[model samples]
Target: MRRTSLLAATGALLLSAAPAAAAQPQVRIHDIQGTTRVSPLVGKHVADVPGVVTGVRASGASRGFWFQDPNPDNDPRTSEGLFVYTGDKDPAVAVGDAVTVSGVVSEYYPLSSGETPETTANQSVTELTGASWQVTGKGSVPAEEIGPDTVPQAYAAPDGNIEKTQLDPARYALDYFESREGMVLRVDDARVVGPTDTHRSLWVTTKPEQNRNPRGGTTYTGYADANSGRLKVESLAGGDFPAADVGDRLRGGTEGPLDYSSYGGYVLEANALGQHVPGGLKPETTRKQADGELSVATYNVENLAPSNDPAKFQRLAEGVVRGLAAPDIVAVEEVQDNSGPEDDGVVDASQTLTKLTDAIAAAGGPHYQWRQINPQNDADGGQPGGNIRVAFLFNPNRVSFMDKPGGDATTPVRPVADGGHAALSTSPGRIAPTDDAWKDSRKPLVGQFEFRGAPVFVVADHFASKGGDQPMHGRFQPPTRSSEEQRTAQSRLVRGFVDDLRRVDGGARAVVLGDLNDFGFSPALAPLTDGGALTDLATTLPPAERYSYVYEGNSQQLDHTLVTPGVRADYDIVHLNAEFHDQTSDHDPQVTRIQP
Candidate 1:
């Protein structure tokens, strides 16, 4: 908690016992780690700064060692530890080795591939570069416990940019983590929020009760409640990272130096790995629709292709047959063409749809027929040349698809009055296919279907993905979701189309469903459900069960299904893929049983 203001001068130090050097105050780790995020002593050289080695990252582009001063300052705003960056060169230091280091202080930012340090909303890691250290003696690196009380309720400054803000460990969690950068810390019996990843890492939250879902993981409901108690863990070199699923417990605990990384803002490079305790979490299956209930479901199959592993196709089919209970109409998104990711001109997905239906039949589900308007080759924003599109799979014996002609990739179908009722000009048509709102994105696939001799309009949509948006946890607080702009426009366009249907016939039975690629509460989503033209059925679920996708340890809803106000429907978000580590797709399919 100690704080010190260094000499106002900003230049190279003599690094010698000269009269000029004598005038400068003695340097400490806290002095370099100033009250603010940017180091006050940056660009200045210091010699004989004393500390003990707490950890060493021997590999990677950021090869370095962390050291902490045994004598700490009382100012909680300043940290007592620092990272000595020996980029590409080995420090050859071990834990518990008391050391005096000499180097130039600087700020380091881990940039993504192709990102330059010139301009960004990213934060910097204060470190000592061009450094040399000598082992003075043996000492212990202190480890602080991060219990429930350690994290503050506030996530960060309201403005989101906490870069120049002074450290307030007692208030904002981001400031608290930034204050302890490069310091040893410990967490006990941490609960897994984000599941284990292929990178040998997982996210665990210290405060287990903060946003608990019935399934044992934290939920991300909005921008304000970010679940700040979350922290990342990784085992030391040559050790296996613990494997755990959502709601699983990190038995015992993990201890190590808290380092910053590009993968996540902060990381605990674990010297002692935590044991994984399973939480008995399993995929959930929904009850099938009763007779006369025309069930419609939406599932983002995660870029499925005919060339993918047969197992994946089979699992997806199993999910549709059993997990979703074989809904009468399934709106499938991300159905890649036969070539998958190959950058060829193949845009036909008949092979892909055929493989899926065959698998569904093999899994003992209904023999389903598919309908879709294929997008232009490589025009849709997905895997190159895959030309992914939203499609429909219907049990022809139960519900029949109307056969109106003239549907194509670039053709926009208009809403027409069919015998005093609302109907699509074509059985399968693309909505505003050439509009800029859907540029390089999947167009909404609108189709007309019949059940019990009554016609119904269905709009299957896969809005733009949130790819180019800034990271929510990045230095830019409440980071800008620029990608949402497109989706918002997409929502408004689809909403207008839905309203057109409602105007055509006051009692038009319409179901709008697919991977909207947005949260139910998002600004983009609000328009779709605005004016009561359509009801976001996903919102009817218990708050804890609303999520359909999991990203960065935050269980959130990115897919949705909506229906006209006059339609009576029962909705269920079948929790099958997201909660489980083993999955057929990243998105959970939602089904709505609508009455005829």
Candidate 2:
């Protein structure tokens, strides 16, 4: 934590020493102690220690250069701002570069990370900052030191040794019998065992529960006998078997006969598990013709990117205004705002949505107003060039906005433990962990509105997470500790919110909508469903049309519209067109007509 001021005059040494240089100072060190540094380090000794290059910004009017190095760890010892130096140099620096310098370390006072470092604060530079000391040619190492030249071999299973197994009703427990924690095996013929709990259960006669070793990377599948509920077959591997209904099958690996009582049950990882099959629904189209009836819809719009420019932020307010039949309210998720310097002057997403509201007005639709919760700049994930978010559009004619809301509607939304890691692991079109800025960017938008003369509470949410083939950290079925904690907290918060709403009007009519970021069958939605506070209308639609987004060419619904039991009979939840998967929107607009 070197705290001092970096004087601009400090860089004068390298600038002056350059012309009459003897061997040309090859190394430069611009100490970023308390202020900004601005200088070039082509052939100077440049030094910086344990810092992340936030970015490379060009200096003003002079084609000069400087790099931003922010302290990655929240350490008080490290300074924040740009380190600058000067010399006739080509440093070849890039964003996210980490380096160490051994030149004079100076401090600059009265500066901030907000403005350019050198211009606002004291700056210093070492004459020999970035000099290259040594050069090595290719193949310089001894052949023996380079290691063996043999091609790595893979273990090939003996022919006909890979066996497939199926389960029958009488052998329902067999699925738990064959799987072992660390050995990767395949399962066939598996079906979703139960919706018994919020964590959807997948039952496979040939698959057992696998749990990760809390201390190491090993995994195991555990078998428990039905007769005594005692553990058996701690680990099993080598084969392709399916765990499904009596006849269905799929292949998967096994790693555990986990201690069910100690760490809950063993988690099962399906070898070739398909997405959860949507539940059956009674098909009936019901239209509302009441004079003041309002049709509201909420859609997740999974990774909706402007055509040809997946990362570019396109304003959808116009499409939302013009594409569908006029609805009183529409809640959307994954709205983006590309306003940063990184976006290269593309349309700001917030501006785009603003235009969408204007489009609604222009289309002779109701005068629609909108609200959104923008995550902190650091919170970004999901798709490239897109900032995932949740927003609400309200028609002034149908509902009047409350001047001040009760809850903090702008906080970053948290994910439930079960859904967190899985959701964050499978965000499309972007790298994981690195692109986790928007992982919790979404927040539930709660507003008070008049629903047909009666005041109703409308809460729109976009839950934390994304889709993933494997659990967080490749932990077996269920999920790992980290992912589970996040999702559990998320669920508790949502449940608390819903409970508060019920207490507001003695459990009056309420509607919850948006991309919950979980399937209809996920336990995350249990609070609303089990409490009978909300009705899941998405489950009432056919499977083919139920999915709002597709992954690996398979369709699965993540968008939803739910209403309270009090008003469930008064409205018909309709799953509109979803067949046009990639055309208008990734999610099909769900239209719900509620009686006034």
Candidate 3:
């Protein structure tokens, strides 16, 4: 769980400072794991701690064994189980053997190898290091059962420093988990809320009735509504982890040691797995646009490039063509260049676009033409050298791109008065390319198009991603969203530019669409819809079908499409990729049919 292996930097230091062979304190496991979240006996020497071995991990990069005291102290604030980190050596222990352990107690704040407690906002894993054990006899401790009714409804207490707070298992969920940090827990008929990943892990909800969406997942509406009943499950003994989709049931029961890691927080390293029962989750497709309507869609074809596998292009093309029913215009994000990710200064994406469009044509869709402005070499901040940018793809027979020649990487696109309406100074141009709000981020591309002989200005945007922000389950309550500052500034820039377009013509048809990377109700989304210049279409969906992305079992929205008053739009967030196991991209593409 630490940044390094079991022999953590802090643990190695504590091991060297072990006390002499003097009489050590005879303490119980509950006294070591006090009422507070942090152990009071940290960095102290303990002798002859009694426990029974419940699980052993003698093989892997993380090798450890878990033991639990057979008798509980009748206090909910203390746990009986303990994990013995053997560093790289194997511990000769069995599941039922009783042992007396003598070692130094240390706190390894998993994942913050170089960070001290004052510098990091992460919880620590209290373990006994530099340990030697003696086999006493045979014993067993039945694992404590965790169920839907047992988990607290309150997610977090909003306390300032959670590490010093007393355990309140009757109130908050975070405290309940902390009270039983290294204990063995069991779940029966656990419902899968998040799909299995490549690292042999999946998420299951203890409370099935909380915030459940129509797609068999939990819905994350705002910051305070985080569902904390979700628990991560992984195999402990390198056995195969069970694979299941959303709503699938892990029938029978699954029992294991409740270990903590930096990746998923508290995890159930299962020694006995449950049977996987399929929930029959399926992908959803939307209907095609009507004859007199223009369809516009936004998709994040995840880091697509020519060097990617053919199946990647084909699958994404199939989603655009078949799942979305072939929208007339598509604003694609993360379109990498020909020499994808190779820092050779090659920034052209003609080959990548051509391949995608060809695959769409082969999938029985219309012939599409693409337009894009390549960014300066490594100017955008995606992968190190994968010059990812936003681009447009339009069906030539249905809509025509107004081609102008003055657009480049650094020039800002302008609006000009033409025939009592607004027109772009350069078609397929970047909006405020030199603005500080868009520094090292993908610039918004504004394209002018004519659908059914009417002027339509489309602004394609891929705003700053949500990196560098603290996790929802971090030590800080109501996690800090520092990344939203850049997105809010970028939204204001887009709002100002759209206002300029409307000033020229009060009835300007502007469709702003792409991966916005912020929630629909966030402060960052207010600027785009605050002044009435545009109406956010993401709010038009029902509560059950609102999200376009799923993260850690919470379905949420990140991609969006907004429209000015001149265009009458009907929005549909196609639920193809986000909910299913077979995903071409991590996001679900959304389309809007407009009648101008």
Ranking by TM-score: 1, 3, 2
Pitting candidate 2 against candidate 3, the one with the higher TM-score is: 3
- Model 1 misses residue 153 by how many Å? 1.5
> Cα RMSD (Å) between model 1 and the true structure?
4.4
How large is the C-alpha RMSD of every model relative to the true structure?
4.4, 21.3, 4.1
CA deviation > 4 Å runs, candidate 1: 1-23
Q: Which lDDT values do the candidates have, in the order given?
A: 0.85, 0.39, 0.85
TM values, all candidates: 0.94, 0.44, 0.93
Put down candidate 2 lDDT per residue, 1-596, tens digits, no spaces: 11112442355445676766466333212232211112233233343333332222233221112222332224322223333332344344443345433344322222234544333211122122322211111111011010111111111112221112221212222122222111122333222221112122233222222221111101211111111111212111224222222112222332221211111222332222433333332222335335566667675555543332422223233344444455677877776664432444343456646655665666566677776544545354455446656667777766665434222223322211222111111111111122232254455565555665565556676666643222211113222223333444555655565665455445465677876666666555566577666788766654334555432122355667778766743333333322221233545456676664
Q: For each predicted model, how many residue pairs clash, with residues at least 3 apart or on different chains?
A: 8, 122, 0
Query: What does the lDDT read for residue 476 in candidate 1?
Result: 78
Which candidate's lDDT is highest?
3
Compute the lDDT of residue 70 as modeled in candidate 1: 90
lDDT (tens digit, per residue) of candidate 1 on 248-350: 8877868888887777678888888667889888888888898889899999999899888999989999999998999999999999988898988888899
lDDT of 3 by residue, 126-178 (tens): 78888777779999888788888887978777876677788898898877887
TM-score for candidate 1, residues paired by index: 0.94
